[model samples]
Target chain A: MLPNRSRTSVLVFLLPPLLLYCAAVLFPILQSLFLSFFSWNGISDMEFVGLDNYVRMLTADDIFWRSFFNALLYLAICLVLQLGGALVVASLLTSLRRGRELIKTLYLLPAVISTVAIAFLFVRIYSIDPVGLLNQLLHWIGLGTFERAWLSDVNTVLAAVSAPEAGGSPGCTCSSSTPR
Target chain B: MKKLFRAAAVAAAAALALSACGGVGAASDPANVSPTGEIKPREISWLLSRPADGAVINIMKKLADDYAKDHPGFALNLITTPDRPSYIQKLETLAAANKLPELFDTDATPFAQQLAKQGKMVDAEKLLKSLDVYDDYRPGALDYQRFDDGSLYMIPFQFELEFIWYNKALLEKAGVTVPKSLDDLPAMCTALRSAGITPIAIDGQDQWPLERYVAYQPFRAAGPEFVQKLKKGEATFTDPAGQKTVKWMAELGKAKCFQDGFSAQGYSDAQNQFTSGQAAMYNIGTWELPSLATDKLNSEVRDDIDFFTLPTTDGSVTSANEFVSPSGIGMAVNSKTYDPLVSDFLKFALAKYPAEYAATGALSPTTTVQTTVPANATPLYKKALETADTLGAKQAMPWDTQLDPTTNGRLQQELVLLVQGNITPEQFTSTMDNTIKQNAPKFFK
Candidate 1:
């Protein structure tokens, strides 16, 4: 769309950044792909064992399948709850004119908190001995018998760890779907 | 339009400059000093990976202050990443970028061995020999940090072992004696529960403690050599010894020996429960010695805390004398950053570490450093040292450390399943054997 001289100028300007990006990100990703074929402990000699890592991961590794299925379950929950809940909240916000900013800020708090901080906060909230906030709430509600180690129980652990992650970016999702 | 172009050009130039300064070739210029030995201040960065409560950082800060008083040319800049997994990630990232600090604390991971192979880490053994402190280390302290080929890469900070701390008063109240063998544990737990006390407090959420429990019965049944054989695929986890070990562990779980909701319990949670006298026993490493010595614990039980090793199983080849003694985190120096001043600082730090450690009722890996037990030292600390003396070189390597990383992860997960009674001992061992077999070729020849 530009004149020949302008196009040349634009290309010159873009070349430096393009080369820099390739050096920083793309090259390392490509290198990792190459390294994946070899059996290397980083300290020892790299032995070429083409496709063995993949073969093992796909076949004999039961944990890999467990983790894969676990991840899919998390994704499904996030899609249904996080994105869907954000849409509902965004609709409610759009109907409100008064205290809009305050409610929005409160809704966005979890989304804005650092991942490390959220992890630590959730860890404390799930602690069993001192009784975490969740367990304490259950006790207050006269449902104390239902309170068990949320993070440790095989039935609850996957859901416990996933809950925070699902709640983390709700505000971002809400804003993205909000009508201008 | 012209102003926008100028700003863009400036931004690109700045980015390029930053990138240039980041690579391996860009070592910061050394500070110049005057003839009168008036030195320009230069900060030697140290990346520490340790728990803040361990008082290691406090002691290091004190040492740095003392060093500064003399040199007046140096300042120490410490950056701590306290969590182990994140700390290892940061170290690996820095090493990959060739931007490691002048000094850094690290575990004896495969990455550290790789760094040694690449000649990027200082030869700690050679440095110790030069300082005439080569003979100072306790027997076998340095051996644990060596690579498969016997090359030393890390300087051991503290010698550690896993042990059980029991409340003597609680045991007495329950009319249960200290358990001398694995068989005695179930009865002890039942007696404690009958006396209205929680039995064993374990950190099941972290899962490593559970893994240790699984490893112990096997360690007793088959001896330490079995682990090496298992790693090589020569021996399977489904071997009778290993299966029996898993079955016993599952039985303990079914018996409710551990505290209620233990599967969700954390290390600190378990510790607090035991120290507060809510539980009869706590299992932890020697690193927790300082915490045990602290007055923060329940006064009623603090004075009554004592420890004992897990007793051997029936038909066990190894005795209770053999224990899980792994080397704690070690400090490594950047080979590229080595200078006379750095070497002097290290010599001073290593010399003072043992003495400072003793004040907190903890012992450094060095045997040569003389210490008078501090007035505030707990009796449990004395018991820890006595236990350490009996361990010697026959230390059981942790399953996580000995097995390949991928296999180790699955092993921990399966261990949790076993403890949860979600999987049979046979199922757990079969899964472990399959995973170990697949990865053994990578780790073993």
Candidate 2:
């Protein structure tokens, strides 16, 4: 099943893909790395200012740091809810005997919807006047006073945006065929 | 032998894939131009930011339909994005790929300026001059979209001016008259609040309105040059003009002049609040005219709506006649257009757009489009038409359009935080000043 061949054969076979990958992905990344050292508006000529961009981002850009922390928080939530929660749900579904397929399909609806549609849906769900669905649910449960503008409030905006990703978690039901 | 042959084929396939990247068609070609110098019959893709059901979209559709009836072969394929940010992103991505549509629109920002600088956008000044309608546009209408070198690249469409719209009945119920000056607004707000009505329903989530609200005092005190000077690092927010504006804005926030949880309220939500009679006043631009005058939801309160120009602030140099007037979204052509018909269609569409837009009760940026409010029109529509004649020469550009992209974005979020009481007024001004200073050398220079 094997042909007698030298090491040169293997090297020749590997070279094309390696070159293509470097040109398409690695080259742009390297270019960005080089450009990061300059102060440029993307259109104008570059002014070399080594490490100043990094320094400005770290020291002066509060929003950048806030976004960075928010991203980390999102990752933590996603790992917990998406991965851990999915495991729990998949196990529970495996134990079910009736209408398991229908429930799985219903839960998977959000994952099928476009992200933009999901975002607009959440915007409606977070509206303050006429009462958004979330607030309405809270009001129905005698927690009317607790209702606040989820998206407008700085305290709640992160949570509001994060809810869509969490809702998109289908709880690993599709992986039910996988053996332990 | 089979394994060796398959490996060889895989390597050959990889080389083919890499080579195909170069074989792709160029976004633009000079060869598309005919030897006769006449525009070839072709369809031009137009990327529009307007909603599918928006007033402007309807007007554009009507014009396109009329143009199609007249021109047999030429056509415009209008593509739209759901929202502004996504629309801008789509344009930017297309630009990166050198696949920009024949015509599109964008905000006045460093991104648009960059496109002009790179010669990716047509010289709008030249095009309008060729069409002999350059002078017909409202004076200072195109000022917002000019580059540092003073080359314009976008053709402005709708002209917008900002003011406060209050329910006449609600104001009367609170025993308050129209405020003659900014100093009177606090008292009016207080009286309305005591009457158990929200004083103002501002779209705080939009951030542009909040920025304009903060700029009112500085713009009045320092005149139009203040913002331009600030952008160039010649002025700081620590100046009296800047401090005065920020202090007044914070005071309004502290007084709870805006509707409860207004910071979280969206544009449509705030508009609904005012129209539904839950709020006394709604502050927005002239673009809201159609909704204010004729929306089905405003049927009950339609008779009660009227506007007052932004009131005079303390130390104001300009009179109350002056307001924030700037060109709305403007169309720009792709400099690397493959089809000459693209330019031809733009020239044809622009000449007819004014009259068509006016028929829909919308204001056209062109001075020639005569506005005639129907005799039986609602009082709100009539009032807007009357105010059009009184638009002062000292029109201030919206803050977002004037400031560089990085500084403008930071200022938008920071202003929202300031109104939320999370930061002091001083902090807000300082942040904006510092952001402008940092970005000046890169953007302004």
Candidate 3:
């Protein structure tokens, strides 16, 4: 129902941003998809390999499958912690009368902190030689026998790396889910 | 509406087609220099991958400043990326776009070989020869920078010998003598562990440190030829040399040689473990001599620090003197930037570098230049430099710089699993062989 002049103005305003988006995002994705059909070392001349790269990735590359499964596990963990935990936290926050602001601020702290700093913090927490916080806590609680290098153990490394990512920003979800 | 949709689809298709046709422009022809051309002073850049505080960078900075004082309007810009992995990514990306700086650090890997093949790098041999300093370099140092076909394209600056630094007090307390042969290592580890000492500290987080262990046994068992052939898919991991290496790695794991959770430990963490008297032994190169052979270390452990050369194997083809003695990463000059000014600056720098580098109680890559032991340096430091003179003909080339990137990465991962007892030696061999078979042809050809 808008006048033709207004519609033209809106289109004109949107055109620059749309072009920029295509150049920055869409172009790279399409380029990668196109380049995937060739064998290239970046510097050398690329050889056309058709679907060889895909075939190799799907069948011959064991690391690919390992990474694929690890990604799935990461997704599941994030869903449980972010979605399910956020619902529970949101409910608890709604009932709070005092210090609600402080709780929310504290929960949002990790989201504001740089990822490098957070990674360093988690590394210290998982360190084994000098005894990290996790191991120290286990020892103090009379569970010293269970104390192991969390980050180095294959059984626990996935969970160890995943915990920070999934649990770090549950506050964002919690805040969104909570009613004003 | 249908017309608009059709237009959009066609535009998208056209964009994709245009992008597919787009290619990186070829590098310009190399700069030509007249014999008597004026050496104009200008800014030059070096993309580096060394520690900012390390002896190499310190000496280079001083030299650059001294040169700048004489050449008005001259500036030497050093772009340093201390972290290895990040530096490699940056280097490769720049190289792909043919935007490499005046000079850049590189390993003599297949990738560097490709660069040389494309005439992107200046011929270092010719440059050095023209400057009359070619004969001054140590043969081993120069050899380390040569391609598989013995083509020299990069210049070496630092020479180092890797050694197993041990704590004398810890060895005496554990009642274990220094291992005389490669096979004696596992037993020595067990004896140290029995006496409540962590046997060896390793920086497994970086993976290359553990990869060094994988190279040692093969070097001792079959000499350097094994890796040279193995990297090209001419030899399999099932070969005797490879079998020895894999089994030795497994044995080291079984004996509990490295500290618990060593795979997660970083460079600084492992160094701290040894320096604090928690670990009995550490394997590192002479580049660490400043901390290891000086009072800079913890006073309690400083006096106890001593080192031994790599041990020999029974009936070993390689000599005891032949081990992991590397000249560090080499610097390649961009052919496109090889002007008269760059040539003049290099001639001045290369002449002054050796004497200045040696004065810091570190080994230099030139045979003609001798290190002047620093006043504060311990006797151990002098002893290490003297040992470098009697080094053998063969050296254990680090596998990290030898194999293609894909195979090398898989090997590093598989090595961790092998040493962790997660995978048997047989499984390790099979997996590695398959990886080399698949990836080696792409690089080697």
Per-candidate iRMSD:
5.7, 6.5, 2.1
Candidate 2 chain A least-lDDT 10 residues = A171-180
Error of 3 at B183 (Å): 0.9
**Top TM-score hit:** 3
Model 1 lDDT per residue over B80-116, tens place: 8887667877887787567888899865555566576
On lDDT, the leading prediction is: 3
lDDT of 3 by residue, B49-120 (tens): 998888888888898899999998898899999888899889988987668999999999999998888878
The reply for model 2, stretches above 4 Å from the true place, is A1-31, A87-118, A124-127, A133-145, A173-180, B1-41, B53-73, B93-102, B114-123, B140-151, B295-297, B334-347, B372-376
B178 Cα displacement, candidate 1 (Å): 1.9
In model 3 chain A, the worst 10-residue window by lDDT is A1-10
lDDT of 2 by residue, B1-445 (tens): 4676577557656654453243223334322222125777667777878768876677677666677676767667889885776787787767655577888888676678877766777778877877778888877677756655577888887777777888999999999999877767777888898998889888877788778887788778998888878877888888988887787877787767887667667788788899999899888877777677655446788778888888886678887778887677777777677345665666677798888777667667888887655444677776776676777777766777777877887888887777777789978987888888888766766
Per-chain TM-score of candidate 3, chain B: 0.94
Score chain B of each candidate by TM-score.
Answer: 0.82, 0.86, 0.94
Better of 1 and 3 by DockQ: 3
Residues A67-164, candidate 3: write the lDDT tens digits. 99999999998889989988999999999998888888887788888888888888889888778999999999999998988888888999889888
lDDT-superior candidate, 2 or 3: 3
